[model samples]
Target: MRPPIDSGTVLITGACSRIGRELARQLARRARTLVLVAHQKEPLEELRDELLASNPTLGVAVEKCDLSHPDEVDALLDSLHRHLIQVDVLVNNAEQGEFGLYEQQRWPHIHQMLRANVSAPMLLTHRLLRRMVERGRGGILNIGSGGGRLYIPGMAVYAGTRHFLEGFTESLRLELVGTGVVVTRVEPGPVAVDAHAPPSWMSISAVRCAREALEGFERASPLVYPGLAYRWMMRLVSLMPRPLMRATGMMAAKKLRQGTALLEERGQRVLLAGGPEALSR
Candidate 1:
């Protein structure tokens, strides 16, 4: 069954950024109301203004919230409650990740990643799911990543969290099968959000990704791979044996380790030549 996108209020986290912004822009013409949640107020307001300019009748609310903090998420929900805005659709789109060796990552940064990528979505779902169930109509669109399916050495923690979402979304879909609350996960490959081209075979523009994701969610598809080329590639990869997948991943892991070694060597030379202060600089 298709989600009631054209009928109810949709709550979108990370509503100020690339995919989130595009989703809000597109959904403005569809959803009766849009609740835009982000870490900063200014960008969210800017987006809201832009949306209002195009669709003057659309109801838009901007909520500044850092999803990594539980208190902030709670406050955000409270604020929504006070406004008498019940969410009919939930888009768990906010995510943060550090691209480096797991050991080199700071504890605080790692914790924040976990909170944003995993804890925040889980908590939001828990708080809002009951209302959706009671209302007998709702939608959950999880913006996941291809990293959830593959083994990546450098992005250990980030990949792990995506895997959690992959599993969680799939199981949740099964549980809510008969219920009107439709759930779908969109696992996109690299998305080219900037002028600089990403070095990948499976990359699509953020606008296209958002459009495809929404289409899939509305159709109540279990999983969506955004790009056409990337979808085919992932379909092929899924058929590969586990050992073969691991072996292919090992190649990437080796290259990352080699790059780390070269960086260490350069750091050592700088330390010896110009002292600790120079190295820091």
Candidate 2:
């Protein structure tokens, strides 16, 4: 069920960031051509250069497209068509998330997140999948989140989008079962980027996550939970009843609200003690 990797043309969105960059780096050695899509032009160019320096024969095309806009996504597709690059694999890795109470979140940001996390992927898939089906060989790798499985009070929209992806990818995989167009969803918990370390049990490095994700996609696995400890923990969580899961989420939400209240109190104390200047710092 493995889709063609070696000598394939792979298109990866958010190619300048952590997991996306790492996926590009790892895939460069095996993929014949790579279409690296990102919003930042400088970083995308830099990544393309780095990939070329290591593998001179590899074909790297840097595309600057903001996934928050449907027009930009369309333009990206048009550019690929003009360049005559037929993508053999697609990695939907770009996403946006805002952490706060849904009511407190700004509408613009929420809309951006909706477009980036949900609309863009769906549009890209709708546009590219038919060609893949006609070609009879391709792969789609969807980057999802653990939040899709659990309820979180602060990240309502973000979690909802992930849940959409979880269902979309699984259903798409079933539909494409014998088409040789593999579909896989990699659900990762919190990931560590740069020098910021994450809890050993709940997170993993972006590089490791990307590597495992690619491995899972190659095997055409319907779902992949990255990180050793996180995978086992999710397995345990999956066995819980819906009621217990909701209770656990409620407890976590309560703790978060308490923590926020404490922080607000501390800030208010500082403001009252030394005026607004003290709280500014």
| Model 2 poorest 10 in a row by lDDT | 269-278
What lDDT tens digits, residue by residue, belong to model 2 across residues 132-205?
99988999999888878888776778789989999899899999988889999998876775523554666687
Please count the clashing residue pairs in each candidate, in the order shown. 0, 0
Q: Report the C-alpha displacement of residue 162, candidate 2, in angstroms.
A: 0.7
CA lDDT of every candidate: 0.86, 0.85
Q: Write the per-residue lDDT of candidate 1 for residues 1-281, one digit (tens) a residue.
A: 87779958999999987788888988999888999998999999999999999998899999999999999999999999999999999999988866666787778888988999999999999999999989889999999888889887778887899999999999999999888999999998877655234525667777888899999998899999998889998998889899998999899889977888788888832111111112123
Best by lDDT: 1
Candidate 1 lDDT (Cα, whole model)? 0.86
Residue 4 lDDT in model 2? 74
